[model samples]
Every structure is written in structure tokens, then in C-alpha cells.
Target: MEPCERARLHAYFSKIASQFAPAEPAASFLVTHLLAERPAFVRAVAAMSRLRAVLPKPKSVNAAAQREVEQAIPCDTLSRELFTDPDTALNYLESRAPGESIVLLDVGGYFTPTISELHSRFSGQILGVIEDTENGHRRYADVDKLPCPVVSVARSPLKDPEDFLVGQSVVFSTEAVMRDRGDILHGRPALVIGFGKLGSSIARLLHAKGVQVTVYDIDPVRRTQALSQGFVVARDREATLAGAGLVLCATGSLSLRGEDFPHLRNGAYVATVTSSEDELELDGLPDVYTRTAASEHVTRYQTTGHYFYLANGGNAVNFLHGASVGPFIFLVQAEILAAIRMLTRAGLAPGMHEVSANDRAAIAATWLSYFNR
Candidate 1:
């Protein structure tokens, strides 16, 4: 090649490689590349590296973190493999099925990986998948790409036909377990209020277990949508209170209080999977059963003609029940284990959802593994 042409080729190749730097580093290099004519100014570019650290990381980090913990970053890594892959988890869920075909309801931002696991392990036995957000829908099973039954939808549509989807669908759960607020109803007619994505999943999970379900959502649109999906919509607060099994209050918001508790059924086993105080007002109500977060989030009150129980006093419902951690890896590992047991009938040897006493140590171990520390 000619000398001038060779120099131009070298410059072009150099420019292409510089394009791959991190955000701030890329910007400074771009500036330097342009200022190469002024040699002195180009050499001063090292000063800009500090500015890159100050700028915020992309919001994609937030989404990834949400995918990790199910909520925000308030919790620690309970299981690392959940964020990594679905083998261990798929193995666990498969163990639970006992040769029976299994169904799973995944409600969150990251569900594609789980569906893939199900498709691989269960093969023909795998059912469908649903999620809340539009991104989740796109990221979920690609019906065209995969050779299994996966929904190419963000929300389960009311169009076509509303059919009853069944099987043992483990939900995108939280960290909370109902230790207090006794009178647990293992099975009966249950009133589950709030029909957003999470509530719908919980209602479906119960329905699969053969429980009579009455659904309520403040939004008429959700009620209409849920009804078309075969849910028996509860109209009156009084009628909602007349039920006989359990009452679960779940709105997307985790900051719920006693004000959000649904009117109960006669002997209802109430516990919220959303936030604990979604039942604050019903606390101490005769048949009202709930998780233990009420201790941190509830306040008692007596009203005219009847006693009004606030749903949440202070504590969060998910904190008391199973936390909404199933979507991401930290919680993902536990969910996969459940799925493996459910689908493959495999068992976890031990330390499935174990938590360490020291927070720093746990975080360090997770960080080291996540970043190869």
C-alpha cells in the first residue's frame, strides 16, 4: 500500500477500537480524537477520568438489581445461582412435581431464563408464562425462537378466550413468612383484593390448589380484565367481608397501610404477599389471619357500629411473608429449586435458602462471585 493510504488505514482502525471505552472514558477519548490537531490539548485528557465516576450509572443497573432482589437492593444475596442460571433451580422444581405435570406463574421483570429452564427440563409438560411489564413480555420466552408453549405477551390478554390455567405455579415471592397473626386457614374460600399482576398471580396460585377465589381491585379496568380471565369479581366491600376462607391484600405498592385491608370473610385466614400492612386495619379481627410484619406496621382502632382494623401498622407484608425475590438471582436460586422439585422431582441436599448471620460477609461473598473478586 502507498504511505498516505497506509496511515489513513491505521487511523481508521485506531478510531474503531477507541469506540469501545466506558461512557466517560469514551467521551474523553472522542474529544481527544477530535483535538488531535492541537497536540498539547489532546495530551491533557487524563484529567477527565475522575468525572466519569461521578456520573450516575445507567438506569439499566436499577432494572438488573430489581431482577436480582425482586424489589430494590434492600436485601442481601440469599442464593447466588439464581442470578446465574436455572439448572439448580429447575432441578428443585422438578423434584416437587412427583411425576405430575407442573405449572409456574412468574410475575416480574426477568422471567425468560426461568421459562427456558422449564422448557428444557419439563419439555412437553411446561405450561405458559406471564409477567407485569412490557419489557418482561419481550424478554420472556420467544415463541418463534423456542419450540415450546411460551406466551409472547406482556399481559395475559382478555381477548380470544378466557381459560382457566392450572397447575402448581409458584409465584414471584418475597422474603416474608407469616410467623404471627395466627388462625392460619390452609384451605377455604379466600378473598384476594387488588388484581394487578402480583395479585393475579397469587390468586391463580391459590386457584390451582382448588380454593374458591373472589378477586377485588380498586380499578374497574383491572376488575373487568380479571373477570374476563375467569376471576369472580367481588363488588361490595360487605360481600367481600362475607367470605369464608382467607383474605390477601396486594397492590403493586409496598407502602400499603391499614387503610388498604379488604373487608374480611367469616373466619378468613388473612396474610398479604405484597406488603404486610396491606392488612393493618384487619389486625385483631376475629378470623383475620396475616403474616408477622403487622407488628412493625399496624395500628388498632374501633369505629362507630363496628371495629375498623388498619391493614399495615408499619412493617412490610413481603418482609413477613416470602419476599418478592424470585425474579432475580439472589431470589432466583430459591425459585429455581422450587421449580426443579415441582417439575423434575429433584431434591436440594441442604442450604437451599440459607442466610448468613453477618451481612458484610454475605455481601462480600456475593460481590466476589458476581465480579470474580
Candidate 2:
């Protein structure tokens, strides 16, 4: 975006910043994010309470953004290290957080595993956690016990922005792939795994682009929903993989595995819309198919007469191939701010929860007032 446009967006955020203050002051907060490049966003969240440390994604960090964060909060408060690994992130948190009066502001559920450790070590004083991804929310479901409240926007009605952006990313990536290999999407069959918000959006996007789409979801309700939406629903994985020209996994679970590779058709392109490397099972790719045809973002594997393509090397293909979510991202940031505010409320029950409908609607209405007007 142009500098003038960036400044205008930041000004809008600043106008709405006061609407999201925490009810009770937090001792500290640990934020795990890839969008720390947005100085205005970082400063807005830091203004909510005392920011203990930031666990920024290595891919998202820039010298200017880091400087912005340091200038907003004390330099000593921000950690220079990126939180990529679970163990390292846990260790860093354990050392810095005093345990009591701390909240986790997370995007990928990187802190899910450490929640138990933090609760045990800190005597259950961890305030709460705010998560923004479906993959991260899944981790919360697996846990039988949670010492503090956890709110997720991934499963909430407020995820309209993310849903819209998911479609946008797919369109951009599909166009790029087609440009590289003409008419790849023309009259081609594409398989989409998972029928949740992101998956459903992707299926529609591809269908609108004239690619035949078949959606697969483990949930009977989701499968029914996909079918009702006028999209073909796949009954089995092997069958779907056999006929698909493009296979995209948006399922939060590890949908693609090592054994599933053999099911893929020759000249097929497989990519992940879901978060993390495990979603696409990148470890399963054999070394023989090591030809890098389209930079590190796209991997090519050929065996005998068959060729297969992997987008973003099993990472979230959208981020690798398309631009950021733009203004829609601020909606999520606002949701995170609201979640933090909710955490300060008295008697919030422990366990996974959605950011209340009231909070979501308020943010949406506020956003529309600024841009929709």
C-alpha cells in the first residue's frame, strides 16, 4: 500500500482504540503473531496494558517494525528472539512471565501446550488466552482442563473478514498458478478438504473461477452444508485425490499424510490453505522429487511420467502467494482487543469459548461506521 493509505488506516485504528481498553489492568501480555510488521497495531494493543514481551514470527519481522515496537514499549520488555518452536517459546515465557496477571495474545495457538505448564508453575494465575486460528482452537478442544478462559475468533461469527480474505487469497494463488501453467484451472476438477469457514470460502472461490470443486469434510453436517451449497462432496479421500487437478487442504487437522501422496494423480497440484507444515504433511515428500521449478514457494516432484506440484511447501499457500489481508486484518486485531477486555471481566469460566456475539457485532459495526460510510 502507499504511504498515504497506510497513514489513513492507522488513523482509523487510532480513532477506535479507546473503545477497547481492558476492564482490569493486566500485569503483562505475551503476543505471538506474524503481523508485528504493523506498528500501529502493535502500539494499539500495547496501549491496552503492560506488554511483557512479544514473540514475533521471523518471517513477519522487519527492522522498522521492530523499532516501532521498541519505541512504543520499553526496549527491555520486547524479546528479540522469534517464537517458532514450542519448547523454546515455552522456556522463554516461563522465564519472563511472573505467572500471575498475564494473558496470552496468540494467533497460531503456539502457547496451547505451554498453558498447562504456565498454570502449574504460576499457580493458575494466567488470566486468559485469545486465539485467532482454527488450528489453534483445535488445540484448546483437545485439552480436558484449562486454568483460564480462552476465546477464539476462528469459530466465531466475527471471522467474516478472515472468510472473505480466504477467498481472495485462493483467487490470487489460482491466477498465479494458471499464469505459470496456462488454463490449469480451466474446466479442471479441484478437491477441497474441510468445509469450515476457510474451506467453504475456497471452494466457492474456485467454483466462481470456473474450476469444478469437490469438498470433503469429516463432519456430516459440514458435508451436508457443502452439498447444499451446490458443490460436489467427496465421500472418500483416495477417490477425491485420484480425479482432482488441484488438491487443497483447509482442514485444521493433519488431513494430508505420507501415505496419502500415492493417491495423488500425475500432473496434480496440491497445496495447503490450513496453518502449519503438518497440515500438508511436508515431511512425507520423498527426496526424489526435489526439482524446484517455481522458487521455494512452489515445489515440483516428478516420478517416471507423472509430475506433482506443492504450493508454499506445505505452509499456508495464501500468505506465500498473495498479499496480506489488508484492512480486514484490523478487524481481527479489534476482536483480539475485545477478547482481552472480556478476559478482565469477573467470573469468566475456564475452558474454550467464543468472543461473545455482542463484542463481535460491536467491532463490526464500529468498522463499518469508519469504512462503510
Candidate 3:
């Protein structure tokens, strides 16, 4: 993935700021996002609506980001704590006026309070919620119905390119990890669980990197798709792990566990790009394996018979180890702006909703025009 040109970023987001107008205007919004660290992002969002408060996630914030938030967003409008800290996030939301029409802007609702607590505290003030990641979409899975519309970029068609770019980032970072550990990536067998959009890109990247890659997906159609792409498709999880020197999970599902550790090859390394630790269960293995901190983001585990590793403690390794995908993030920001605008006016029947085809086209056009310039 290429570094985004700063000039293009400013011009593109400035155009976004000029064109963005929510049909049913919100009184205010409490945005919980990793992008809050970017001054351009703060400025663009401020142009869209009355951004009441911002809860920046820990992983996305650094010294520079903290300075940017302080300098760009109003002190009264920014939460001091990491939004992932649930108690602090709940407290901040609780202090707000119940009657204030607020939209929950987030990547995965990490900063937002629980759905039940949100309704209890804010009542009908929650105009809607917009989420941008697969894990965030899964958070609402158990709800029989939602109080307001949910505009999810993760569930929408918008994630197609984003996940592909992420796959490229993954291979870049994974190669670094492999090199650090003295693992010969080329000619080594690898297992990729889940043949979804993210997994497919990963499989393609791995193949390009000269790894013998096998895919496992429960969805029969996805499995067939992988097979059609000329990659080996595993019968199941066990079949996938067998003799695999590297394993990566892109499935949002909680599929891997410590019990399955025995199935892995002696020197296999495991990593994940999903938002949850569920993709690679760390419960029992965390205690049993002798750990080695390879870096701030990479950790290695050694057992008597095998060596295993967990990237970013089983969190999304892309953000943890590699360069930030600024261009792709800008596209999602555009999608988010459009989603918030649509949700304010549209009466979506709860659950998860897609960005309208018109909105998608407009976003694409905006990005293409900017890129072409």
C-alpha cells in the first residue's frame, strides 16, 4: 500500500466537508473513532455537524495525535480517556443531555456504551449509530431489534477495496514478522481460515509471496470460490492446520482455540486481522506457552514441541505492525459521512443497513476525481 499524499487528503476531505449535509440534521454527535487523531478528520467532521464529543481509541492515538486533538478539537468536545475503557465511556455519555439528538460515530462501538445502557440513558435521543468494522457489526447480532438505524460500512459493499488494501498491508507486516523469526515464508505451507473478502485478498497475497496457501471457509460458496481461484481448499479447520507453517484468520468468528494447538505444525505462527481475540483464542495458550515479546506489537510463544506466535495479541495486525492506510481510511470516512447523513433522514428498520447505491456512487466519484487530479 502506498502512503497517501497529504495534499490530496486535505483537498479531498475539504470537498467532502463542503458537500456533506445530513438531511435530518443532528443536534450533536458523540464520535468514537480511531480517526479522531487526524486533524483533517476532525476538521472534516466538524464541518458536517455539531461534533459534541470525541472519544479517541487507544491504538489510534499517540503523542502527535493527542497534540492534534488538543489543537484541533475543542477541549470541551474531546473525551480524555480511551473510549475502549467502557466505564469511562459510559460515564461521559451519561453526563450528556438525554433529549439531545446524538449519533454514535464509531469504527467498532469500542467507545460507545452498551446498546441497552445507551437507550436507558439517552432514550430517543440516539438518532442512529454508524459503525465501520466487522466486529462492530457483530456487536448488535443478539439484539432482536434496534432503537435507531445502523449504517455499517463493514456490512456494506464499501469494504471491498478497503479489505484488499488491508490484505496487502498484512503480507507486508507478516513478512517482517517472518524475517524476524527466521521463518522461510516462500515454499512454506500456510493456512488461511475464512474465505471472505479479507481472507481472499490474504490468500492472493500469500500466493504472490510464494507461500503454498490453503483456505478453509464454512460457506460452501466461498470454499468453491477459493478452489476456483486455483488454491487448495481444506476440508475443515483440522485439515487446514495440518502441516501449516503459518496460519492467519480473517474470519470474524471465534473459531480457533487452545485445544487445536496440537494440530499445528511444530513451528507454526498464527496471526489475525479481525477485531476480536475470538479469531485466535488466547485463553489457555497464553498461560502454557513461554512468551517472547518480539516487539511492541508482536509476541512469540514457545512450547516444548512447537513454537507459536500471536500478532498484536490477536488483534488486527495491519494497524499494529504496518503503515496506516490513509487513502483507504479517507474513502471510509466519506462513506461514514454519507451514512450519517442518510440515517438521520431514512427510517431504516434497525438491524444493519447498507449505504444507498447512490451514496456509494457519489463517494466513489469523489474519490476517483480526487485521485485522478
Best by lDDT: 2
Whichever of 1 and 2 has more TM-score, that candidate is 2
**Candidate 3 structure lDDT:** 0.70
Would you list the C-alpha lDDT of every candidate in the order shown?
A: 0.37, 0.71, 0.70
For model 3, residues 1-373, the per-residue Cα lDDT tens digits are: 2246666777888787666677556744544434432667766777776676556554444456556766655434343344445555556665653466677776655534355556555544666788877766777554566666777888666667778888888777777777776766786798988888789999999998788999988889998999999999987678668778888888876658777876777667777775444476677554667888976666767777777667767766676553465466677788888776776675666667878788778888898898755
lDDT at residue 275 of model 3 (Cα atoms): 45
The candidates, ranked best first by TM-score, are 2, 3, 1
When sorted by lDDT, best at the front, the candidate numbers are 2, 3, 1
List where candidate 3 sits over 4 angstroms from the true fold. 1-7, 23-37, 74-90, 96-98, 109-113, 276-278, 294-297
Which stretches of model 1 miss by more than 4 angstroms? Answer: 1-22, 25-187, 253-269, 276-316, 321-373
- Local error of candidate 1 at 117, Å? 46
Q: List the residue pairs that clash in candidate 3.
A: none
Q: How do the residues 8-127 of candidate 1 rate in per-residue lDDT, one tens digit apiece?
A: 434432332242222322111101011112121112222212111111111112333334332211222222244236775555444444343443333332335555555566533543
Which lDDT tens digits does candidate 2 get at residues 97-164?
55547777776666666577666666326778888788878887777788788988777765777677
Of 1 and 3, the candidate ranking higher by TM-score: 3
